[model samples]
Target: MQATRTDQPSASPVAPPPPLSLQTRMVLLSYFAYFFYYFCRKHLGVATPAMVNSGISDTTIGWVQTAYGVCYAIGQFLSGALGDRLGPRIALTTGMILSGIASLAFGLFPIVGVLVIALSLNGLFQSTGWSNSCKVVAEWVNPVNRGKVMGFWTTCYIFGSIAANVVAGTILARYGWHHVFLFTGITVAVVGVIQGIFLINRPADRGYAIELEERSSPATDNTRSGFMLMIRQPAVLLLGLAYTGLKYVRYTVFSWSPYYLVSSIGLAEESAAYASNGLEIGGILGLLLGGWVGDRFFPGNRVRLALFALIGMIGAILLYRVTSGTGGLWGNLIGLGAIGLFLYIADAIVSGIAAQDIGGAENTASAAGIINGIGSTAQLFSGIVPIWLKQRWGWDAVFISFIVIAFFSCLAILPVARKGKLTKA
Candidate 1:
């Protein structure tokens, strides 16, 4: 009766975390690199009011954003492949420097045609940041702990958005809007130079052999075969479709919320910019929680968690629409926070964790690029359609559209959720 069970196998040992110094270096580098990427990207949104006041129509400004989105979407595919081939270190540094130059051009020449061309170039360069940074993380970190690691790491964008708004708002208040672009461009370029000097592309470069999960694709290098292989995955395609709706919702909020506050709520320009921080603050929390909960509770099933978050996002949008008119500043802030929390929970899972899991070690950047590229297409409409809706049917129509988009985003993943996990096809 007291005999021990000798035939039963013991549980497998959990892998130890990556080397502390290497992990720290990778995390900090990727975090800051992507963080400054936002500086060049988000400054346009902050400076929108000044642009409008300078006799640029809202529709024209929307078209400028649309131009940026188009090029950004196209660049995702090319940059993802480049990251895989040339190494993320080169791709990332080049993108940052070039993006900075583009921003400078946009600021120096504020004419409509120049604004379109500059922002378009900026969009293309800005595309390099995410996929390459993702490739670096995939190389340095093991998949077992990737969810938690990427969770905190992904907050770079959220924090970047917050910082960009604060800095841009302050700069706009103190100096003219032109200074916003000049300062951000200079800052990002310097950071790019520093990142180029210090970034280590992979663990092997540092003489460490980190264990990685094997993927089904043999051509995992930054080659055409690998790109095709990743694009063919059903999960990747589904995730991309879902991300389209999600990105539309996110870009709309990011691009227009300040305008909404100023125009609809009667807030001053500076106040509108500062209040927008509430969204990013909630996003930071969402990403952290999503990463922790996905790894701790769901393990390999990030899509399921993402589905839950999508549903929550739908609810938050609805709540925001209902209360925004009567809720005042506090109400708007609360709604924005709630919307950010749920939206980003789905966002981080779909674009970051799930993409990593599906792509594994080999095609990390390609998978991310494909998914994000598809999602970025929504930015085209996000930039222009909100303006159309607001002009034609008012703000309520715009939010109603977001609610519908969030619901469809949730539905896009239902088939994958039924399969019960994210896996390569």
Candidate 2:
């Protein structure tokens, strides 16, 4: 008696497993979506000086920057809820479209209030990028390949930031701020349509079982009374609070790097922009190392990977300080670029890789969203940090603050490290 299809052994060669090629498309689409999201998210920082000359007061402009963060926080809460239920594919695509519109509106009319609305709208949509990507990665890949795949996916932010900084700086200088917004808006729209058509929500949706069958459908049911259950979760709370300090460093570097160079280091506007791109390049390399280290040696140990990131971050900070203080333009370039690469790698591992480890597929988005939201909220200090430090003492205070925060971020993970949990068993 031959075994039927239903009775075929899990190891049966004839039964044929699903191709992971769809998973490959999912990764590419998901990553490119994030790449575009960051492009939209980051262009404003580059355009700040331009906005200032357009009759907006520096103080008022700072508040405008804050608007992006305010919206980002709201996006964190909403995107996760949507991804957990509606599925990542829809959530991510819709977000790209919404952000595309807001980006255009912001470019067309540059009013602070209107731009705030647009940023909020953009934030709302942009929130889904990470969450949806997490869902795609979680559903299709398993423990063994997750580190490398996710690590590769993690490079997109640096790549996105590098492209935005280089392109936005040159373009804004040549074509003005409006053109930057218009170009990014169109780019994001194109990415959105392409990803939506090509990406599937889950492996099952593409007629495939999970790579390792990570979990069952009913078991993935994480629906609960909104934030109530979420807050109660230890892992969730830790994810948010720990990352808040980390965000301060991340946003401060991004939002203020240009200003730091121009105001403190005495570099020209475009030069500062160029220096900042160095950070993104370092980020790309760091992420590559992060993934390899995480999967190869540590295996399922997320905290260990995070700890390794903590060490890299310290080196990154030293470079940031030395480079920013130096008079040579080349020095600034090397230092700032190092900062961008290492710091970004640290974050990529934390949210993109670690969060998925803790939450699994069903709740991957929710986990990432909360962590990202908490970090973005640290931008509450983005404007004030520079102003406060400048007024109270000096520019050195800002760098010192980042150094302290970097250590604190590492120390904050004591709890996470103590409990060595794995997604599998």
Candidate 3:
């Protein structure tokens, strides 16, 4: 025999991963990024009443809200593209910077024209939020464990809202609303800087494996296609339609619940503020359930979970109208909380898991952004819907309009249900 076998090739030892893997760091950083994003974003919502007291008309206020919605819609689509092509870290950090600037601008200029312009800027920039979060979560978390991890991560929305309320309430009570903007802007900016330093785009970017074990599927990563590729998917289109209809109720609640309580239901300002927590609390619960149902009950049937969630949301809206004015302050608070809880089930499934199921990973952000952006376009109509009803009818008229819109939202999901079926795990 030849002497070739005398020397054996040596194998390199594998390096051990750090105490916190890249995925762990990325998850933590992503939560921070989104937490601050919500803080800056929700400030506008809490301050709307104060804005009204500053001389803005309800219609004008609605218009200002519309400006944010319009820009946010655009941002959603564009940021999805950016997230797919450039990576979520860059897209998200850029959005944070933009939102922070918008916050500063909102505080600096209290004029209607200026406020509208600034809010539009904020909305457009922050459009990056949802797409970026989707990309980040998809990157760091595995499919199997994603349900629970996402539950923890998505809780940022509620915590962010709570932060805004606590900070806004105290500051607005003492220093006034402008300070709320100032504090929000400053704090969010600081968090943004930290995110820029820490958040990595994917496990591969830093040499690690994702945490969850997903069902068998090809990878969903890359920047391979254009906007048209995203729009062409039937799943994207159908899902978008359902979501668009659904948001009429969702955005309405976000934008106007406080005003609705204070003006129509006759609750004290502080009481309305506390009651507002109901929405966030309910949302937290709903999202948790949605994730569980998607994993266990719906399992392979992610879309079915979405349909059920949407159904629950419709029921919640009906409950909202029925219970809103029935008992008094306590009743309104409890009713609003229930709405928050039930409505968020759809929110978690449709926007979170369903987006991934239909769109796949490579174009996930883009596809999801387009769908959610289009669906969220209903925010514009919802913005004006209440005003029209109130101008013509009264608070009662507006509440009736709420009922009608909720009913229409229920109808929108029928086609979606027809198209997609859930597969059990």
Candidate 4:
């Protein structure tokens, strides 16, 4: 009773949030950051026909792409671990600036060896954007709305690829491949500066509580140990495994679709780039629809929705292969778009949403790194496999191989769906 007496501390009023406008700004910056990353990366694919025409061999191209893929995959592990330590803001800004420099250097030289070094470096820098963006999204968004939010955000890459094709197509039509690299590289660097100026690393930095309800967990640990801990979890490992196949197929599409259209389907080089937008358009639709389905129909169980999309992807890829030749231009567009839709829906759900749910706030970057890094390792094969299959068995076998992968990828996630709890890492 000695201190219980008269004077009670006055209750202070909690300040109100600055409005959704701030959140919108963060999301927009992140979207553009990723958009530019893809723009810098994918325009090279659009430029490949010209590069090949410039006396670069298909075998050389495969080697160059493999170099990039290897560096990109390895960079994912290193940057993801460092991102957790240094924060997304610094990591993203640094990556964007360096990637742009690398792309610019790639355009300045036409020699195969030099081009390989520059593009490989570009891949190394570009790898930082994925895990850092995942970390940023997880910190700002509540878990309850992560599916829908991430779905909308995932469109950046889809449309980025579309935009890259369109812009790179126009550039190649008018100026040539070098200008395409020069222009896109410069744009990415400028955007990186803007991101450094405006992007917030986390909601808590602005004195706001994260909107998601916290799950029970122990105290936070250091980045290295935490990363190792998260990677060991069964959910993370399975998700990563499924992602490997998904990325293998998707990267094949992104890297080779334009070339296929030009070489096999008989479209002009420029026209192939434009037509390739069908894949991205399909991706955009799939991501939005899939996100809504996950949130509205299966909020507590996303793995089921992912499985459905995977099954649909197998059907879609087969349909695309069947109709690509006989379906006319519009049929090809529609079929390619359908393939994009199915493949990306599964990608968005498994990589983005699952990582957020399973890894929680503390491990989002680590999980993203593990899943995306492992998946990206498949890119090494994206070039190698296509080259081997096309060289030995032809494109028909390549498509059939992808179909087989889709079936197996679906099987990888079956246990996750059965558990019905993507959050249980």
Query: Model 3 over residues 1-425: C-alpha lDDT tens digits?
Result: 77666566689655434335666777778877877787677676677777788887778878877877888887888888888788887887778877888888778876666777887778887788887788787766666676677767777776777677767767777788788888888787777777777787876665555443343344533375635676876666766777775577767666777777788778765566666777777788877776776678666556666566656655666666767776577787677677777666766666666665555555568777887788778777767677777778876665566566555655665565555453211
- Using alpha carbons, what is the TM-score of model 4? 0.94
What's model 2's overall lDDT?
A: 0.73
Candidate maximizing lDDT: 1
- Candidate 4 per-residue lDDT, tens place, 1-425, comes to 47666687888766455458887788888888898888788887899888788788777777777888999899988888888777788988999998888778877865676787888778899999988888888877778788899989999899888888899999998998889888888888888898899998877678776665464355646454657877888877777788888988988888888888888888899988888888889999999999998899888878788889888888888888778887656877898888888888889878878887877766677888888888888888887689789889888888998888777777778888888556635
Would you give me the overall lDDT of model 1?
0.85
Clashing pairs in 3: 142-212, 220-361, 220-362, 244-375, 282-341, 301-423
List model 1 lDDT by residue over 60-124, tens digit each: 87987898899989999888877776788998899999989888887787778878888877889
Worst 10 residues of 3 by lDDT: 212-221
TM-scores of all predicted structures: 0.93, 0.89, 0.88, 0.94
| lDDT scores in order | 0.85, 0.73, 0.71, 0.83
Between candidates 2 and 4, the TM-score winner: 4
Clashes per model (N, Cα, C within 3 A)? 0, 6, 6, 0
| lDDT preference between candidates 2 and 3, better one | 2
Please, what's the RMSD in Å of model 3? 4.1
> Which stretches in model 1 have alpha-carbon errors above 4 Å?
1-18, 215-224
lDDT of 2 by residue, 186-266 (tens): 889888888778888876664566645355355435644323445556765665666766678777777777766777777
